[model samples]
Target: MTTAATDTKATGATGREPWGARAGRLLRAVLSWPNAAALAVAAFVAAPLYWMAATSLKPPEEIGTHPPTAWPENATWANYRDAFTDNHFGTYLLNSVLVSVIATLLVLSLSAFAGYALARLPLRGKAPIMVSLLMISLFPTIALAAPLFLLMRDMGWLNSYQGLILVYTALNVPFAIWILRNFFQSIPKEMEEVAWVDGASPLRTVLSVILPQATPGVFTAAIFTFTACWTEFLIALTLNTADRYRTMPVGLALFGSQFTVPYGTIFAAATVSVLPIALLVLIFRRAVVSGLTAGAVKG
Candidate 1:
């Protein structure tokens, strides 16, 4: 009996050792190859943005010097001060903020209702409507440029905030609807049923139960919409030719044209341009992550 027990123990140990060894080898291989490659790619991508920030801090002479300085000898706020004072950056910033915020709010509100209807209501031609929206999203905005330009001209909305807001909202709606519809569909019907059982109306149920759960999706939608509107160049350039009405993109273009590409000032402006969106993302990162994860899991 002792001899038999000893033989069984040896066999079990041998089997366990090989399996553990194989698992370790597999883990090492994964960590060494694809994971390492991904990290390297991320670093490479981030290098230019970091360089831009660093260059923004350098003196104009240093910026233009042969063999560029990776690090500034003496950092200064001169570039940023010059950027705001010389470039009319303040006005451009305000315009961008106003247009982006209003457009995002409108898109979110409209898309919420449209998404909920598509998700829950049994409307005629729902499939076709969704397909049409998808197709419209696929069409390049450049294709609509000439017609949209003519329309804006006819409406006398050229160089106006209203025109830009209208265009931004329209462009963002299809994406907002797609995202919010997926979110609404993921929400369990049981919650709504319970609300209804408790004598809540459809609107009340949606307001009290659904909207709160959909915050992540809403945040995601708002971020994307705002970013798109804020950075849009082609439409803004064609629609708003007046200096006072120009948003950041067109303003930045004008800034570029004013000088021989003042590297420090341009970088400073670019850095400032990135701050608002970065701050927004950081503030709502948790919601964004949760929304994205939930959407992926449910889908």
Candidate 2:
């Protein structure tokens, strides 16, 4: 009887599991679904980019061969070398960098001021102004292309960096204003008031107190504006006539015309073109997320 009772107690102890251990297992299982889904999505998105890179590295003969190769049979740097030497991609890259940086800076500066005023100042007709800006943004840019062309022609600004910058800034401002305005509104007014009480002027208050807090939103606006200008095709195509003046999009398109459709070189150029934006996102991912969330919440 004593031996049987001892065996029953041991069985009961073995059958019972601690609550903490069971809870941990359940939590891990629940989290695994989302983690697995996220990884799958990432893999799906990365596949095309990987393919582009692989094709770019492959030799010309292998590119159009039957039964596409997953990995390059003979990987070479010839495509990249040709992309620079044969296509003048170096010039195109410079133009793109200059145009994108300048345009982004101008848009951010102007938008910040406009957004700040709209959010904080008590100006008359502000509602109408905001409404008009929103309405303008909704209109298709294609509709204004003809008029813009004419205007640029009249001003002798066609094919000019200044002209491109102006158009980019104009096209981007409304959206920037809307974004920054919300971000500005999200900032507590009490902070500005405190700065004012400490003998800081309005401009100083904005520069010192507000701008720092709003860095995420500013970065978000700048990056978006830069990417848009960098990748702009229609306006760049229409305005720029000279190959030398052409931005990346125009230059890349012209690559087909210039050569026998150098797919390898084209892919190489494309990879280079996308690298900057990708790097920016990777570096400032936190700011981008915060900016997006803040803007959405405030809106």
Note the Cα lDDT for every prediction shown: 0.87, 0.89
Q: How many residue pairs in model 1 have overlapping backbones? A: 0
Model 2 regions lying over 4 Å from their true place? 1-31
TM-scores, in order shown?
0.85, 0.88
Which residue pairs of candidate 1 clash? none
Tell me the tens digit of each residue's lDDT in model 2 across 138-176: 888788888999999999999899998999989999988
Weakest lDDT window of 10 consecutive positions for candidate 2: 9-18
Q: List the lowest-lDDT window of 10 residues for candidate 1.
A: 10-19
How close to the true structure is residue 292 of candidate 2, measured as C-alpha lDDT? 90
What's the lDDT for residue 128 in model 2? 96
Error of 1 at 158 (Å): 1.2
Best candidate, lDDT: 2
